[model samples]
Target: MLFPYLLKVSLLLGVLTLGYRWMVQFETYSKFNRLLLWLNVLAAWSLPLIPLPNWGPTRIQAEFHQSIPKIAQAAPAVKHKIAAYNPAPTVVSHQRLSSLNQKLKSLHVMQWLLVVYISGVLVLASHFFYQVGGLVWVLLRSPKEKSDRRVVFVRNLRSNSPYSFFQWIIVNPEKHQPGELQHIIAHETEHALQWHSLDLLLAELQRIVLWFNPFAWFHQKLVQANLEYLADRAVLDGGFERKQYQYSLLNAILCTTEVPLTTSFAQSLLKNRIKMMNKKPSHYLAWGKYALLLAVLYVSSAFVAPYTLTLVKLPPSILRPALKTLATNDKVNFKEVSSKILSLGPSKAESLIEELKKKTPETTKAIQPSRSKWVIKKNDALFWVISPLATLDDINEIRNEVKSFDAELNINSIEYDPLQSFIARITVHVNVKSGSSSTAKEGTDRYSPMKGESGYLTKSGSLGTGSVPNELEKQLQMDYEKALALSKKNEPYYFETRLMEKITALGSSSSHAFDKNTLNGAAAESAFRYDGVGKSTDNFLKLEPEHRNSELYLNSKPATFTELNSLSFDLVRSIKIIRDARGKKYMIVYTN
Candidate 1:
């Protein structure tokens, strides 16, 4: 999960970074470009927090950018752990044991990767703090000059290069030309006025967090580079001759020292600086390109954004995937028999119930509980949140309240039916502040109805009074199906329709389901938007110019261009475009 989050940060950085590199690199709008750079960093991290209508490209890479950005950015890989809740019974299958072993091994590897990443962060954080401490010491110990800016003369300082930290401008009078000293002060002052040090500090912190990512460092480079351009333009605009300022920059070039949190005057970005200074001013209309960047960002937000993701953690008993055939196992133990019976699946459970009827003639027919307490919802309204009230008339009186918050359904109905092998228990997972957990169904009258835990589930609605179930798709399966069958074609089932209208809320979600948002988010998207954002990888093949030159991939791995001919864009989760060293491009497609 941490991996995917950071990967999103990295991918977003790469995309906006490339957008800047590809569309507009050099122009005279240094101040505006500097702001864009700042915003790019903010957007990279924050965009992942905001969900859009849907996802955009899985990947948009530049040949020259760092490689790690593509890794987790577009690839949705997670380390999984097997059910460690209950120990395996005496007679476990060899294949099941092997799968558990593999998963445990992967969990261990993921733990180590996390440890290594944390260690890197700690080390870099210490270094970053040390740099900040050094700058702070110099600011405090050095002599101050009376000026509008907080100017500090670093007496007998080792590094001759003048730098600015927050509002303090550090310079040594002996190291500069008498006239050039003013220019240097002016340059450093620009940094102070604009609070450029804050940007460097943010970039440094991101570096500490994303130490393994080369693009993070490059992202910092861009931030610092843009700040320098901003300062250079400021100096030239304020009556300083361009030629004289260029000479001053060249003259100040010495054995420059690096300060992580401070903005230095003699930056080594000379070539780019010269190009930027001479570059023509861009037309105001060029701002339109930024809209394309916004659109691209909006697209990326759909997938990586924390769109209402919820984890439906069914009990491990139901998760065994019918590994062993019911008829094949001869020496089945009591626990194995119960697990097999419970895991028979929804459709198979119905058949198993029928078979039970012939075997036990004493069994009573299943009695339907009072419809009052039952959380019956129509099939089409699967995505809607229903009120907990008994009828539509009660919900209509408080329409405003029902529209905003999910009504908590205190479902306590239970019936004893010997013929009902499945109890049809509904346990909703929510975070109610005052509620206590109780067993959904005890082993009351054997026939072991599938066991599962019900936790509190609500979409930004706190149901302090009772358990609230947001998604009743799986739990209310039988009820929903029956309601659908009862309804007239193209008409709502009157009984359940009037029953669920008040509860239908949260059409789009951004819920956090414990530890598996990506899995849950993807599943929810697949369920709600049957056709998710069509990936653009295969679509690139339709372009004559691109098909002739670009490389292709399916699911992140290299593939021949011909594969795109058979590719179904409808099935794709996302599409990525990568450019290699020779300017050749890569089009990759991902499917669920």
Candidate 2:
């Protein structure tokens, strides 16, 4: 969240700085105009901080609405249909799944980057506060005498160049006569009187937060320069002779201070300050440049920075909830069977019927007073209640009665024995009478677990690959082949037990074991570092028992001891460990 705002603020500051640079080059504006420019720069930096109102009902919202499915809109009825088949699972598109995965990964990366960026901000802010503390210490301990109610004069300070910080003016009195020193005090007095310290503090704080933005540094310089110009103008207006002030400015030598908040009397860039003092006032038409600033802000608000953010409210997808129960009929009747097997007295039977009707009015409209098709054995406590309710409410009610034993009610939908009904069947009515001739044959199984060419399930029962897309299959196959090949080549083929023991004993530095000087150049340099041979750099050997590289291969392939060929130590004619010209080590076991 902060990152996005930082980016926007940086962009605004950069544009504002460019505009200020271009306009200031062509005009000698008054202090008021410069102040306006400074405030606009600050405002541009703060634009991203303002909260934007959500702009709902954009074109994107319309696209989102079109993309989601609506449950009320039923799938069109098929011309040629088959009944008593299980429903297939809905297929999710790969594009949708891929996008979701990418978003999750991006969220993780953003979280890590946010941590790093905030750490940098804290470090920069700490450094900034340290500078402020150093300046405050200097202000407190320096020798000072009261100049007036609003100002103080500091003497014997390390700052050779006269400067003002808040209410205190520091100058080395020994360097100038009383008349020249009074001029210096008046110039420093102007800065303190105007409260220029507040502006410098704001600029310094902005720099600490946006240390990475180059334009922030530029803005700070411009602000400080403008404040100096304002101070110079104020001094001249206070009755200082122009020629004498100009002579004093040229002869002044600056002793730089660490604190940027102070208004230094003899700062570098003296020439620009002198030119600003003598330059004629800008023409009234010069104010036209400000109109360009307004235009830039308008463009930014319209395209770059939106103040109004609309949020679109979309209907939830059909998949968000379970399939809604469709009402099959306006009313249904439940009839009690012959009171033989399960005779609840007439009172209890009537009460149970009333309870059922109250709980599920959509499924149970009335209880028939006549005998039902299902008959019960006399004296039995449970019996079937033939029902004309087939909606989802009826199904749920029947299930609840069985589980809770709510009342002595049984229906044909329930099976008495285990495994009696493992699969459920639904009966839906659809008219198969078409005016045109049909290709479907009579007495055909339309769902025989085979694929058909007509794109619809045929009498032979084929519906071509269901929903498995062809492109996805091809991509999966290609990836599977590559993985299979990689799996084979990455596995090493190890030699037999005795050869392995010999190789292990040989170690990474065989020359050290044999007290020989065969290892030279690159090999000699790495002789002591036996570990991390095959791990860090690929295609290298690590004969040391504790250290092994993952990329190290046995005869160009990774191998476990079990994968080695059976061989006896006596059958091995020679054992040689050699480092090739490229510094790759190879272990060879040759048979007689």
Highest-lDDT candidate: 1
Highest TM-score model number: 1
Estimate the TM-score of every prediction.
0.48, 0.43
lDDT of each: 0.54, 0.48
What's model 2's TM-score?
0.43
- Model 2 alpha-carbon miss at residue 245, Å: 1.4
Which stretches of candidate 1 lie above 4 Å from their native place? 53-107, 150-156, 307-592
* Stretch of 10 with least lDDT, candidate 1: 376-385
lDDT (Cα, tens digit) per residue for candidate 1, span 251-298? 777557656678888888888887787777788887777777777766
Residue ranges of candidate 2 with Cα displaced over 4 Å: 49-108, 254-258, 307-592
